[model samples]
Target: MVSLTRISEYVAQTANIIGGVLELDVLIVDRSLRIIGDSDLASVSEEECIRKDSILAKVMAEKEQIILSSKEHNAGCASCLQRNLCMVEMIIGIPIFFESKILGSIGIIANTLYDKEKMINNQENYLKFIDRMIELLTNRLKEEQALEEISLLKKRMEVVLDSIDDFLVLVSRDGEILQTNLNFKNIFKRKKPKYLNEVLCADVVDQLLNDSEEVKFKEVKVNKIHDFLLSSKPVIVDQKDHGALLSFKSIKDVAVEMNELYTHSMDVVFDDLVGESPQINMVKERIKQIASSSSTVLIDGETGTGKEVIARLIHNTSTRSNAPFVAINCSAIPEDLMESELFGYEEGAFSGAKKGGKIGKFQLASGGTIFLDEIGEMALHLQSKLLRVLQERQVNKIGGLESTEVDVRILAATNKRLEDLVKQGRFREDLYYRLKVIPITSPPLRERKDDIRLLVDYFISYYASRIGKDINGISDNAMGILMEHPWKGNVRELRNVIEFSINMSTGDMITQTSLPFDLVHPTQEYDEDLNIEVVTQRLIEKALIKYGDSTIAKEMAAKSLGISVATLYRKMKELDLKNSIG
Candidate 1:
């Protein structure tokens, strides 16, 4: 191994091995750029050899190995007529290395008398081929080492699971308790279980065996002392009947773990919401109240208000916390595919349908909450379908004849006023009433202006960690501007503004300069934003004065505007001008 460090020794040692099987002379070289070693042979002498002079020197200089096949091409071999009788038709050579880092060269010189057929067939001439063999051996060694390390890890994990106080049970296919790390022996103390056939409880194992071979298993709701909490996963591998892994844990511990996972998985949390005013506190209180309820919830807020955050908070605090809480924006879905997305169709239900059918939002959230965002944007047609499902407590697939009973609790959030929509014939009044059963409204960020500092500080630290920098907090001047801004886009807008500020921040502080140009210099034209009532009053007064106190003014106003006289009368009543003369 030490000698092989230089190319010269490696070539000599390798050549010696080949020489034992075949008649050939060989030489090796080290990167010393010197002749470290060589095979002392009969057809070659140290004094007559082309070693130190320049043959190997040229190979090193060019970063490539040299091959001399015929004595005719070599002036040195040409003089020695033994070349014509040489065995090799031509010598083949290649460079040697590991991971692109070159080591050295290995070469064999055969007499013209050597076997012609065998020389061409043997890869013994290419030094790179030998390097490849070394690599394969290295990989195999690594794989074996990895397998050993994994075995050690599994053993250590087993020990750790055993040390915990919870009921950690690992079961097998034949109804055997392969391993029980929990205090099951002390808790149950069963001579047998109530079901019998229960191997853990010896007496019940016989009855369970009568059912036949165990193909599948489930580990659910196993308790330690009582129902603190637990996470169980069945070992479903490659169609094999492995058992399950059941664990016992506290509810608080699960929450902590989930919070940890959120830090790693989700970029933002409830803290990213910008609001601290009493109105915002009221929204939080409503959310807290809604969290404990198992009934349907309807969250109403303006477009920019954070309805999505309220839904997330509800999900996080609810009884179905372990199940997935999926959100689907009804407005974002394309009309044609919306039905299939909500109530999945079987394969071939449509040309592009997937095999074995698809699971819809309700099925995906079987035991969880489904938040339908922008619910009012759903077509007037789908509203009826949704209403049917809500009323019957079931959903039928797009093409399926049978209905699936889903235990999902619905949470529909919308910015649009459904009550107004119902009156305009854009939404069904019956469906609107059903959805508005437990209404909760989120106030706009401007209304909750007090939350500005809390949100800004949260975002600064949040984005700082995300960007791997230290943006300590928002500056006092920056905070004041943030509080004063009208935040028309509400919490969503505030998040964007804060994110923009943090991105522009330097030396651990954010300032006004970081704000977008439009935000700093708003270009709102006051003329375009006309007061509806003032416009109506001016038109009314002019019409009344022009027509000389006639009732025709109201009729003319309604007719010209393409509205009913009754609607115009209602508007006048609202403005206290129902039957007034100019």
Candidate 2:
């Protein structure tokens, strides 16, 4: 569908040139026989449509040249509808061809007898001249088509570049700025720089242009002091370096991506802390009051008292909830590796450092919160570093030349008394005060005994559904035993006890026998008037009844009674109770 109208200006100029040189009028029509070019408009109207049976239409249909003379009464023009009105004495119509496909037809008409005689005498020369004009027109059309396709491709490329979130720039091998995307333009709020050195520092520009290989994740400042993670690759075409493509991603945005990748248990919200006691309610209120602030929090509690749970609740309700919540156990990691792990390290900083270096927990938790569990166990030297980081809101990586600014909220938890550690010179006093900007205490389960029933129900429902059991409730005797036992391990221990009971139960309810052996037969308290011999005899009888008389059963009984198998056998023989075995 390459139409002659697309190059109408060229076609018109060529028609006029032919008319001036040969003293003959010319007309050019497209594939549909629509008149698009005319040299002498006085003879044929510019909008005239050629008749299908005309000599020019016949030439186009046959894809060949046709010559007719008025005096010869040519049969080709005999069928023309306007034969009487035709003013031509002689004419030559030739089909314009490109790549074996006819695009249109060009008609050269001789109106006067002098012109007609001139054309007839030099017929071979005239045909050759017109064929050359057709060649020029086809070449012009090809150039126009190429320009059209290039324009379309450029528009598509712009759309793709604008959709990217990162700032993008295209540079030449000489470091001249060739192009930039919309993000780059918006950030700088000005026209693109003429050269890479105009925006990036000289050293960065040198690395980008001369590297010949891709540069990845190089932290650099652009337009003076804006931090970015810059990546660049040389643009190569046909084994020759053309230029390079540079992409700059904002460091804050990168932090969010890393947070999403590493942070876990994102669903731990305030409601997940299941408790309803005066102490627990007061703690909840305090969390709600202070969650909006960015001050450091020190949570003090015994083991299994849900200190980490309170920290997560505070974080989930804070302004940084949408960001990361990184948790690290200070005691779990070795003292040798704690510094590098918390603050990160650069390439070659140590004997076994990663090639590209590593981002620290603080950087990953930027615009978020970081929880340090068992902070009292951190080394004294590390405590000094941690205090400096808290004071300055910055982190100096291992072997790094400069410190990086961070915007992370610190939350440290310890079961031990940090004050006593400071008194003993085991922990830094200044660091201890710095960490406790806001102090929180997680109450043990013994203090919140009223929540025991609710916690038990919650755990039973949770573990029953997970283990696919049909447990309904605990028997009154079992409940009394749980309530009277001192929960030294707190809520975590209670949850474990409930899970154990559900697994051990065969019926819908958790009876006394369904509980663990230790829970069912706790050691009794003796008074001053109690007889030690009588008490020992009754304990042995009860143990034998509960456990069978087999060897394994006796071993279990002896273990439960806090004695060895031989000691239990000697005591039974001395007490004359050997006949008691079933």
Candidate 3:
């Protein structure tokens, strides 16, 4: 609703002009019948100026003009209770209308006989002048309302632009900086530049202004120092170029986003290794000591000895844990594509290359760690390129002229010894030494037999929960079979065995009957000394040596031997093995 008070000043000025020209008092009242403008000091107060029975009120109610000469006989003022107080002999009232709605009324009053005669003689001209004044006041109010709405819309647009995370700028077609978002202002310390060239290079600005389609470029230098990924889209309206909207993302931020997109949700932490043996503890301590370093690491171990697990643990415990931990199995990918897979490739590098090129594991692992498993399997030609990357801390994409700098920590694992491979001319000596800056060896399960019990308990609980079973523990007979079997496949093989046993077991406990057939009944040669007593004595002696001669050791040895501690003690006493301790 448009209020007449919004144009109160214009109403006052219009009333003064008409009153001065016609030599009569003028008064203006709003739609609510409240006087808002008065040309002369009226004897009546503002609240009492307009009455229900006044001529001005009748004109507004009827949405028309009214002219009266005699206040006592005019029908427009006959019912006015305050008509006696009104000092007027003639009156002209015109109602203001806008959009078919009456906003207010304008009245011309004649207090003297000469003024009354003057108004009655020129009543037509007086109405015409007041009508023109109403039109001007209505137009003024519309303009003010439009300006207010535009201001509100501009504020809303600014808020929307500032909410973006990336630095954004609106520029003219001639590269003039028009407006910028909050991120851009923050980066520049709230000091706005005059043109795009003040922040971006001339060539980049040129490409943004001239390109018809959306333009995107990475590693673009900002202010000749910092690198950013820039993208621009021309603002086209009705087949005319207005300007361009540019967005800048930090290269480091882009790398982090890519890492998140490419990373898996394995959630492998340092504690997930789950071992208490000396060999395993030593490996864990070594990882903790060097977790903050950025040097290259070389891990050598037998297959299934948890080399990749150790690498992941190191990454998880390091400062770069929040970033990506990319693992590439050299033996898994083909040798022909190993180079491209390691160092990325250009769009047209090879015959069947992907259209937009592909980012390699190293690039994806930037600002974090990359593990190269089975490094010995990498070809000699690729080794040279790998050496160059390690030496320069940069990578050259295939069929690309420039090298891209990478801030990645390299970690390589192999089941075979790189030293022996280098001696055999299969691996480069320089590259081997470079990778061995921090060498670690993952101990096989056989060497860390002390951790077997813990590993068994962990795997049992894990597999049982995963398979939704109630199996709680492994029986002595089942554990004895596992302790005696040599695990050539190490932890991986042990895990599979436990999973198989859990699946095969029908009861709440895993027993020897649930074991694999080949594991429970292995082929054995006939013994030359077939005496039962001698065999039993020899087995007891061996168990005593393997475990200590303490009472707890005897209990553990008895469990491994698939016997009770009391039976083992009885046999020891019968065999006269007196070296046992309580």
> What TM-score quantifies how close candidate 2 is to the native fold?
0.76
Q: Which candidate is the best by TM-score?
A: 2
TM-score of each: 0.48, 0.76, 0.72
Kindly indicate the candidate among 1 and 3 with the higher lDDT.
3
lDDT, model 1: 0.62
lDDT of 1 by residue, 195-303 (tens): 2134233422332233323322211122222323333455668976465654545333443454446433433245544466788778777777777777788898887
What is the lDDT, from 0 to 100, of the residue 61 in candidate 2?
Answer: 89
In order of TM-score, best first, we have 2, 3, 1
Q: Tell me the tens digit of each residue's lDDT in model 3 across 1-582.
A: 688777777777877887888889998888888887788844335464567677788888899988777876676466666667877888888888878889889888999999998887887887788888888888987887788789899999899999987888999999899998887887777566889899887766777788756766433667666657677889999999999988888766766776567655555776678799999999989999998999999998889999988898888889998887888999999999898889878667899986535566777788889999999999999999999989998998888787888889999999875665675688999999999999999998999888888999999999999999999999998999899888889999899999999999999999999999988987653366778898888888878756656668789989989999999999999998865421
The order by descending lDDT is 2, 3, 1
Error of 3 at 260 (Å): 3.7
Better of 2 and 3 by TM-score: 2
- Clashing residue pairs in all predictions, respectively, total 21, 0, 0
- Between candidates 1 and 3, the one scoring higher on TM-score is 3
